[model samples]
Target: AVVSFTGVAVAVVSFTSIGVAVVSFSDGSVTVVSFSGVPVAVSFSRISVVAVSFNDIAVVVVSFASIGVAVVSFSDGSV
Candidate 1:
């Protein structure tokens, strides 16, 4: 799925069978909550960006001019 604002975009891709979740932003930043029941992975650029991942939980928050702040959370409580 894809969500977009004026100049920002958010995308999500999930694989339920393998328990994988991927979230991406427009600024070449990507956050993967979980992959095959492993850990979380996050990649971001620019300043004032925060990403957190644990077990099956992943959250990312970003702030920029004209972009405001974006927070995304993905979790299923399953390992």
Candidate 2:
């Protein structure tokens, strides 16, 4: 299964005895997996901007599993 938003996207997959899920945003993405009966989740994002521009990136993940991880990066260089 897959879901997508204007600036975001999500995906899910399950096979045999394993399952995986993924979610993506304008500046980030996330993935969740259930392997060997263990559940795990991971997410990451990166943003870069220049000049008089404002950039904001935020990520949130919720799960009822064994492990979850999230990462984000932002860089702004201007004169």
Q: Estimated TM-score per prediction?
A: 0.39, 0.28
Candidate 2: regions farther than 4 A off: 10-34, 46-79
lDDT per residue as tens, model 1, 1-79: 3345674454444434445555556666666555444343344443244445556454444444345555444445322
- Report each candidate's C-alpha RMSD, comma-separated, in the order given: 5.5, 16.8
TM-score of 2: 0.28
lDDT of 1 at 48: 42
Q: What local lDDT does model 1 show for residue 58?
A: 47
Off by over 4 Å in 1: 13-15, 24-33, 36-41, 47-68, 77-79
